[model samples]
Target chain A: METRTQDTASFEVTPWEVRGKVDYRKLAEHFGVKLITESELEQIRKLAGGELHYLLRRGFFFAHRGLDSILQRIEKGQRWALYTGRGPSADLHLGHILPWMFAKWLCDRFGVELFFEMTDDEKFLVRDLPLEEANKYAYDNALTLIAIGFKPEQLHLIIDTEDIKYLYRIAIRVAKCLTLSTVKHTFGFTDSTNVGAVFFPTLQIAVAFLPTELYREETPVLIPAGIDQDPYFRLARDVADRLGYPKPCTIYCKFVPALTGEEKMSSSRPETAIYILDDDKTVKKKIMNALTGGQPTKELQRKLGGNPDVCVVYRYFQAYVDDDSLVSKIYNDCKSGNLICGECKLILYEHIVRLLQELRERREKAKDVLEYYRISTKFR
Target chain B: METRTQDTASFEVTPWEVRGKVDYRKLAEHFGVKLITESELEQIRKLAGGELHYLLRRGFFFAHRGLDSILQRIEKGQRWALYTGRGPSADLHLGHILPWMFAKWLCDRFGVELFFEMTDDEKFLVRDLPLEEANKYAYDNALTLIAIGFKPEQLHLIIDTEDIKYLYRIAIRVAKCLTLSTVKHTFGFTDSTNVGAVFFPTLQIAVAFLPTELYREETPVLIPAGIDQDPYFRLARDVADRLGYPKPCTIYCKFVPALTGEEKMSSSRPETAIYILDDDKTVKKKIMNALTGGQPTKELQRKLGGNPDVCVVYRYFQAYVDDDSLVSKIYNDCKSGNLICGECKLILYEHIVRLLQELRERREKAKDVLEYYRISTKFR
Candidate 1:
């Protein structure tokens, strides 16, 4: 139950939802967080060209840093790898899959090796979880990741803190490029515990460079994660510049929202999100409760219309169920009062059921399928 | 640079040291820190018998915890090991060798494995040495340690923090047994850097258990260190008890007095102590400037006599030269005004030269000794 306060501000505009103090660019500039300008974003769209079919429109390739140079390198046939992870705090939720799926897609799209860290050390230093419990959580989470159809050859899943410890010494060398003050400034951590909690972002940076140093030759990395995770790679990119390693490019998409319509679909509240372990009834209950802005009546839609943009279900359609024309048609009809909110939610509910049924059944049959150790350690 | 206050009130009463506001037993007892009482310590001595030597004349190893059971097991022919370190801050002074020499003797007497850590991590973290510089210091320091003539098959050396991180993870688990409140209370550190700084004590504990775990057998350890370091190991022994691992026995020796007649010989002040690396000229200069308890004149010495018990040069003979009978002969003759202080100082200076000459040569020529690496890693 992460509460959302919209952080009320001054300006109230007429007819549209633009507000005061809500300038994304101004906020980004204020914080020195480099964001893609409209022109740079257009350049990305033009550069992606045919790749946009699988990338942009479905929101697969969203946020980025130094992406233009990355694309130029890719165009010149320079390869990049993948970096992603899970906190393993609770059950794996829809929020967790967006990044891993993006990373998996990038692996197929660009023949890149993927490194998935379990970050159990992070949990060890931060959470009160027992080491064995953290280890078990990592093991279980790895299985859930495998069930998502990640190619065995491309992924290296490291769950142990010890493995990461030797790995972190290298990471700290990169981390040393940034001061604790600088880190604390960006992270807003006030205590020693805060430093321990934030230690993984440095490790995340090392994961990008590890392929080049640990594997054989230099391998660049492409991190696919939530927009919330962009700051980690931003620091990674900064550390790379100082440490003389290739910077990791990132594709940070917004999270797939929960049924309750929030910024994130957290698993702490089970009612708002569907789990891979969820049965048909549970999935149905969650989807039916999902928020939608489709019109309740044709006359009301013609009079007041639906705010399809703010709807959580609409956001999901924009993220996961990636049929562009179908979603666009649904959006237009709902906005024009042709499709009602109830009918639209019912359809999306069925789409999710058909989408996840086979995966759930297979997941139930063999819990051991996820425990494939070779797939984890060797990463093929 | 250390001065000992002449306070007969405490007369080596340890339970209340350093201002008496802190409760030693109550603080230790709160975390189930097993506090072996004075009687319990005597029981442990009975069980250990002649296997472990105490600095009894000095009252250094007064505090004990779980030592009775460990020594009982040891007397019954159960195995144990030793753990110690070299900071490589500078060349080893007489004070540095006091612990290692005693440790080497214990290893010989008890037939236990010894682990010598070259604490480059601690040196770098605590002091201002770069990793490369710290490593070079360790490399150089290893030669001096090898020059001490420790057995090749008993000591394991770990210098790189990068290598030690995972092995340290087990120790960090014990450290996790401690809270920030506990560690801060013990160390009085107020920052994140303090955690890594104070972690060496935990590393020492892990080294104590290495034979049992790493060698894959059931055994304990006896950590031989100066009394100043005893405070740190008290916490380590506490962690061992909590983890169901055997609590390590500790041998706390009194400090070897500086040539300048201070309470301790410190490497920090060049004028105060003779270092292993000191040449004949430097050694002579240090001894000539050394503080003495002897009277300035023949008239005063004949009238007041010398305080040989507090004489720094006399302590040197007691710590290093091994011929206690010769030291007694000189001590008794000087106090009676039969021997002059200058003549005594000259004799002590020559003993230093003669003592270090072989070591300097061995350290200089020991480069070709592949045996040193074996000794360092305890592989031979």
Candidate 2:
């Protein structure tokens, strides 16, 4: 069965950037995540009018699928829609930017209509959360997302508890198009979890193309997400093509690393990643205690400086820093013993601390974020 | 451990009714369905002031959790609502009247709001129905239900395929409260069917109380149904109670049997049941072929003319005939070797044929029934 093959392939491939030190080239092919070729990157750069500097290359934006076609559409003045979502687990993480940023990029370049899903209902079902608590979490998550500077007029956000009939209709149609074997294989569920878990994949696939389902005109979507979730989007792509809609292209960005560099930058593990609400002291401590490639003693570090390319601090710079030229300069200077790990780490920490604070302030003033979320329906 | 016990309880308690001749009383108890007591029936008759001929027996309505409370509140002139639904599976069968009749009783008695869910979308997902076909069935089913004499002003119908956003918000929330274990156990799925199948129970529960989920106000509902569906209501009861809302009471009536003296009547099996659309000649042929308890020859017939108690035609008299005195006369004459099976069957056949002709003619004029299905939030 196709399901079994995906399971076999998921195991064999998907080398999680565990410890956050991933070989970008190897990861691209391992997950079957489409990546821009040398020419494709050049084309993307040209499409941006030499604005390649805004990208997160060597950071999290690692893979692509049919990304070139979307670019071609943009070049031809044809619009595309942006589709992406968050699970609304507990809190938002820097790793969450992997998809949102790419979605933002598509929106800016192609004037794509964006649909953002706050899968709070799904989180509650799978996580056994109380409805009130789940709803609150969804609201909080939405606020944080709005802070990220996604264009309000192009977005559509939904929470599961707000209405129910829509879910049933979408769920049934989704369930009909797919099968048990497909979902069981995709989610890797045992005989224990509920049937809701099995039937949930269709909702995800539906959310990825919800705009199309809502209107007479079908629109193809571009789903931007992290490499960890490549399988889900791949399933979405499969459902899309099968449903007589064009498959959604994926930009499978790499995950942001934590202080421990344990393949992901998760808030769940406090040591690996910093939260948006973290104070300056906590942020500094995390970065100071973070695992690094610098030699133990300062004297030894002065003699052997640091392998900046291998350091966690440098890794953060590659992901969050806006200045690519400065990062490249730091990398070269550190290799020649001109830059120290502690100093480079401090610089990275300062950038992240500033970014999170600025984001929080911006979120506070985001006008009628919920209204903004509903704006995507116009295109549909 | 709790999940396992609940699943086992569901399997042991739920019972689907069989056609021809079901042990309905025992089946109702096994599934935890409510049934009226003889004492209750006596009270209903007394309350009716001997006008029992107009209403379905009041005693048949039992297992109410909030009906009495809702009624008392209504008497105090507190606002309340009535909820009911129809599965758009096929033409509305005579069996579907259990819920409508109950809803009519509630509205007339309490002056409450009435809402009807055209479960076309639910059918689409579970039955793999096309969207247009699903809508068509809803329209067809609605007209038949309306012809039963539901007032236009007192009823509100919802077809899920229309106005997706608000409805989806409600369905997914209910989906979150449910688990696959509950859904699978309810549906009798054991490592069979998809997650969509598991997810379906939640949708039914969602429909059972869409108002409260949408408005954040608890609403009491009485779901009138064939006793066969008690298990589903039992599931709904649990969900409603857990959600801090009132569990719906059930007023389940027994199914009407086919003319063949089978346990249950099935429209698909034409020989087993009389359909609403059956013409005069077809109705006559079906009645003549109907199973009877009479002697084959004249010599034997003189000894045993008929046992009307075991005859399908006699049961029809018990269900449809307006005059109880006439019913008793027919039974007495048959037992006393006066009324033969052929003559008794003809009388019943004539009554049903007349009704069918009038019903079918009206059904033909119920054009554009879909116009009544609206997604408006306002009651007026």
Candidate 3:
């Protein structure tokens, strides 16, 4: 029943909270990031060797801070690493996987390493969850992340509490360059906020420069994450030069709409989010009952045509459906009233169920490969 | 040229900064800690099963919180552990070793384990010092601490950055129970304070609870430190019950007076402090030039007695001189104009030089035993 709202005042986005119907362009503008232009996408397509990722091609990953500079550096034969993180408060959902999928593609194409930070500390600080629970979720999420086709050697999983001995030195360095005023302004923190929550941002910033420390070389890092996470990177970018590390380049993706058509899918609301572990029956039911732009009557939709723009089902198709031609056909067919909501829902459900089933299978096999992905304490 | 200030407004004491002349009794009253009473001293003397330590008899370790309970717990056969720490911003000085000397006494007398934290991270956050320099100081200070006669098996050295993997989990739990408002009020943190500085107290608190985590038992911890550090323990005591850990008991000492007769000796002011590594000649020169309460002329000093109560030399004698009769004779002679500043300085110089020489030799030997004193990552 939720309707999209264009009122700029109504929407909110931060690393910790997301609400209302977000206007992507306005959000980018507010965050001082640039929308990824077609020419830039063409440049990436060339770098990717004649094809762009479906997420990038569809404009799901639509914004950036320093993407052009990263591309330039790569062309000049400079090596770069990819860094991204998840606050493990709960199990992985489809919305959470969107950016990781793009990051995996980036690593596969670019032949670069990935530093995956599981911020168990952050979730423990922000959520009512226990540290042990957050740590459990971190291992669980890491298994799911490892299943997403990342080469074990290329992926270095940095669980916050486990890898803190290495991260803490760099984090304190980053923390020194930041003040309470800066974090309060950046994260909208109040006096009532716990000191752990106030200090968690430094851990995130440290991950960006971790490669430079671990490799003993100034390696540029590219982060592909949701636009909501930009603030941490923004603060990182502000302090990077001072800390003698390259400012991390970030490509931001728009939020994946909830099944109820809310701006962002959240794990707190189980009905609105489709978790990666949800069985085929659960996935089918959630998708079938999802919000769509079809008309009230099928006969009226045949005369009036349907609106594909506002439909959560169509949005899922746009993000997950691999074929450009089929997505185009679905868009056209829905607009011409040829495809009804139920048919569209069934199509999206089939794609998701298949993706989840394949992921679950790989996840079961990921246990054996977990050791290879972990960034060991001995690595330091 | 400095004079003792009785104006409460003129003196300030916090974990990071101290100024003016401190009145220990008033400071303890303001901090809501109880002054060590005669009966408490008798209880401790009975526990030692013989003579009391010179520092305890002389009232150098003056104030406490929960000492009675700790004593009662000991009588009931409940073992206790000791926790104390240093912020390794510089090499160890004579002033810095005062509490550690008492901690060694407690360990020797009571057969308790000790957790010694070197807060390199805190110094890196608060001072202009680099992390590496702070870390270097930690090692250097650890050598001196090991030389202080603690049994290697009973001592666990926790260098903040090195042991962060173990400390960080407990720290986050402590941190979650503390708010920005609380730390701001406790530590006098302002908006300009770095987030790392704000979160550093939790590391200190975690040390108090570390034995419970490491040994898997509800071990009570008692901290022996300067009165200035009470705020950190005060905050820890507030949140310990909430975290299901024992509230740490604290014994606070008055600051060791500077050679220049200032309230506290500090490393930044080299003239005021005598470094533990200072050669004998350097120690002699610093002591000879030290401020005293003698008359301007030698003839007047014979007619009018010097003030031992305000003399830095007498204070040093009281703290370091083991012979009770010798300290009392010096005090009475100064009061009766029988002892002059020169003779007293020479007597104190011999005592200090011998102490330093013995410590230096032990410190050199400490390098061999360093491995046994370190709290290894594997200990977790």
Candidate 4:
């Protein structure tokens, strides 16, 4: 599945950073995860009452570690819950919301609970930002998650600083099982790295087993995150059996591409990302300026056609275009020179503007629902 | 201050392990703490209303970091509390009780609150003990502490596993300020050391600043512990001002010597330490077998007398005998030919039996007092 493109720049990916051109298939191999097979997709489609989430159907969440184990556990009548998180180092963007949207879909389709972690503590440990600033980002990110339509009763939104008691005790046990060398090798940490940073893999790993502790049983968990985060869960899975908890299954997603098609989207690069709260005008402007794989001029574009394989706008269409037929039509039109860069930009812009306008309204309404999702109340 | 004795084995000391012949004065110098001076003792006596606790008066609690600053703050009418802790790795022993006893005296005289941390989590992280077993030790240690006559209302007994929320938020901030190099150099940690062990200094450091956070002001804290634990508070003091909290002052104690006259009394050495719960016969047997600085033969012992300076019995008398006159008499008798090893062991045996019997009674009575000291209820 791994392929190299002649014109595409090579890339590197880690939990904290991404650069150049990322190949999702190559990342899957490098991380030792399997791409979603047709059988697995059919199994999920059948389990979701004869349909699949757009993210899954379009191969956005196309990689996994233990999805088959989760399916088998479910078939045996055992329940599995979803665990995912936000680092909250910056404002929420569509890239951040993508995984949560899929998580919400899983929650509704499978009728399972969700453990949504806001790692404000990790943000402070790993970034140069102040603790208070990280806390502010956590609050802002929580609202964006609430706006994503997750059912309050089934969701446990955990802010690391506010609900640290829930994680820290178990995290110590997990940390003991982990070695400094393992983290150093896995996460590229050096002696110069802060101790908090060196110790943070445990905090991230602890979230996977939280449901088992809460329910007082060996409940299975499904962690849906970008493939970049696989190392922590891989370490968690390796230790879970020794700790007397079930190994958590992982479903990995490809990163949302940057607006300029450089690589993955990031809040640190505002010009390359579209924030969740961006206005329709702002969303349109960003998409219009976004990178695409068309020829240099209209004459060459018409004669040679375009390369949608490297187009940021085409990737957006794949992520947001719910109708499979429409997505196929957009791809056909772009490859056949039927759609120019300006036309494709218009199409992507319309979709993003509509999505943001609706999300902004829901985000305004979600303020009242935040309390129900906050797990800080469960302990305190 | 550094000295090498030809017959004395060279040793090293860290918070985790102790070896060889430890020189108290050298340890003070090595740890960058000052030995208690006559003037400071006089100030403490005046502050305690013309009396010093036996430990302070006898030079058991011998060194300090900021005792002068604490005294100055108290003179300026600023409030301060006492913070001390035990790692619950084994059963409660007199070596563990010595500092808590001194802390009790400070609490009674100055009417300050006590933060007694039972680091059950630390035991699990640092040792090969199960979390449940560590928790069991914590309960046993808490009962022994309760038996020591610290008023429940003025004491807050925090078990790290049970009251983690209070410590973790602050610990993260402290952890962030610490670097891997600092901890590795300070704690002598290697790559094989678990992440929990590498990260635990912050947990220990956080207790020093908890009073400042809880009281929401510049409340000073006094940590009374063995000089071995000085590194954690030293690191705490380095970070406290930047964190906007008053630096914690320390009153360090010399290690209580083992019955074998080895440098330290350790719970890991069952034959060396006298457990508070040891039966009367067991206590007498241990004292009878204890090492003494007497001549090989009774005839030579009578002619040459004994060295009370290095005798375990004389040190025990110093630790347990409340009356200064009684301790002086015992010292003088041992120095001259007036007291022999048999008579000294008998006298020490009688004192330990009485002390243990009284403690056993108080321990039975203390079951009812534990509820008031536990901070678990504050969170639950």
Answer with 1 or 3, whichever has the higher TM-score.
Answer: 3
List ranges where model 3 is wrong by over 4 Å: A1-10, B1-10, B303-305
Docking class of 1: incorrect
B59-167 per-residue lDDT for model 2 (tens digits): 3334443345554554465545666676685645555665675566555654555667776765665566676787888877776666555555566676656544444
Of the pair 2 and 3, which is ahead by lDDT?
3
TM-score evaluated only on chain B, model 4: 0.94
Residue B354 CA displacement from its true place in model 2, Å: 4.5
Scored against the native two-chain complex, candidate 1 gets a DockQ of: 0.20
Candidates 1 and 3, the one with greater DockQ: 3
lDDT of all predictions, in order shown? 0.62, 0.64, 0.87, 0.84
Q: Return the candidate ranking by TM-score, descending.
A: 3, 4, 2, 1
lDDT at A372, model 3: 84
Q: Chain A TM-score of each model, in the order shown?
A: 0.81, 0.88, 0.96, 0.93
**Candidate 4, residues B1-380: lDDT per residue as tens digits?**
11211223577777877778888787777777888899999988987799888888778888899899999876776889999998886567778888888888888988888998998888998877898999888988788888888776778989888788888878888988888878887777877788998998898889899888888777889999977787788889899988778899999888888998888887877889899988888888889899888778787777888898888888898888798888888778777777889988898889888888888898888887788788765434
**CAPRI accuracy category, model 4:** medium
lDDT of 1 at A328: 91
Clashing pairs in 1: none
Q: lDDT per residue, candidate 3, B44-64, as tens digits?
A: 898888769888998988999
In angstroms, give how far residue A223 of model 2 lies from its true place: 1.3
Give the per-residue Cα lDDT of candidate 4 at A227: 81
